[model samples]
Target: MVNGVLSPKETIWGLFSATFYTNVRANLYLTGSSSCLFLKSDHDDTYLADKEGTDYRYEKWFKNYSAIEASGMRCVKILDTYELTYSTRPDARVKGINMLRLPELYYIITEYYLSLENQDEAVKYFDKVLQSRGLTGYADRQGATLTLEKVIQERRKELICEGQYFFTQKRYNQSIYEPKSGKLYPASNDIYVFPLPENETEYRY
Candidate 1:
């Protein structure tokens, strides 16, 4: 584990390319383990400075890279994980939108077996997900036991930055983990429910 988080080189990580577009004028909030993956600064000075007086400051800033590396966060921009074939073509970019993946079906089957109190079947299905993602060792370490908590954690790791975690929490009525506060807010209607848009409400009979 990296920084108390799992950082396996799972095949699932490559299924989508999540990125931060600096050109876009919009607000984005990143929560949970995914937030821990970002570099603290964008400036080269934060990493390369070795001046006599400022060396200490640079050293402190450099430690952030250790944290990022430990978290196993992919540096997509630097690595060029997604290639841009045409300089002028707007469509030659990786789509960041979330879509249903085959792994979700495995997780759903695993949950179904768990609900039926069939641990063996649950583990069997759950292992399929881990195996596909080069995480069979994780399953082996757990042996024959499989719990909902284990399933939930695997989901969080496998689905990080995929835009499905919040809905997963809501479906399970699980507490939301707030990274800034380092606290979990209990599940409640106030937190889960969304008010109808003003336009929709005004037009309704």
Candidate 2:
């Protein structure tokens, strides 16, 4: 197992990896809490939908840390391991946040090869990521076939909660997949580009 790649028990695993190095100043800084988004009740329709539709590897990244409520709904905890740990002990030194990880590099290389129409080299790096994530049978089951769509889905599954998915979609100009609506939001500048602030535009006009 990679030391701090995806283990929920590791303080610095999710959204960042410790396999490369540690973030010594993490404890001192206030990391934003994503509890509003991730800490969901079992009764929540969105949570249930996600649990049913998301990849098994994505489900493995979370844990239920809260007690069952009177309504029989349990809290489906996700990505709070490090936040809970660091918040409790502000004085503790922890690993620094790693913006990029090796798996991401592997995905990048995979995409690069794919762009060149080199399916073999693309599969080579893509399989490396799958193997690391304990999905050794995935590539084999697909007969080692690779496509740009497959690569995009793999990146979505692997890089969830890391703020990379939007950029990936933008880079490819792909339509956004809305899970709740079960529809594709068409790719366009209206969705992709941010509007200039009113204050900034006023002076230029």
Assess every candidate by TM-score: 0.53, 0.56
Compared with the true structure, all predictions reach lDDT values of 0.49, 0.52
Q: What is residue 174's positional error in candidate 2, in angstroms?
A: 3.0
Off by over 4 Å in 1: 1-80, 83-96, 137-143, 180-183, 196-205
Clashes of each: 0, 6
Residue range 4-50, candidate 2, lDDT tens digits: 23433333343433422222212111223222232222223332321
RMSD of 2: 8.4
Compose the digit string of candidate 1's lDDT tens values, residues 82-115: 2222234134334333255666778899999999
Q: Which pairs, if any, clash in model 2?
A: 22-95, 22-96, 23-94, 23-95, 23-96, 24-96
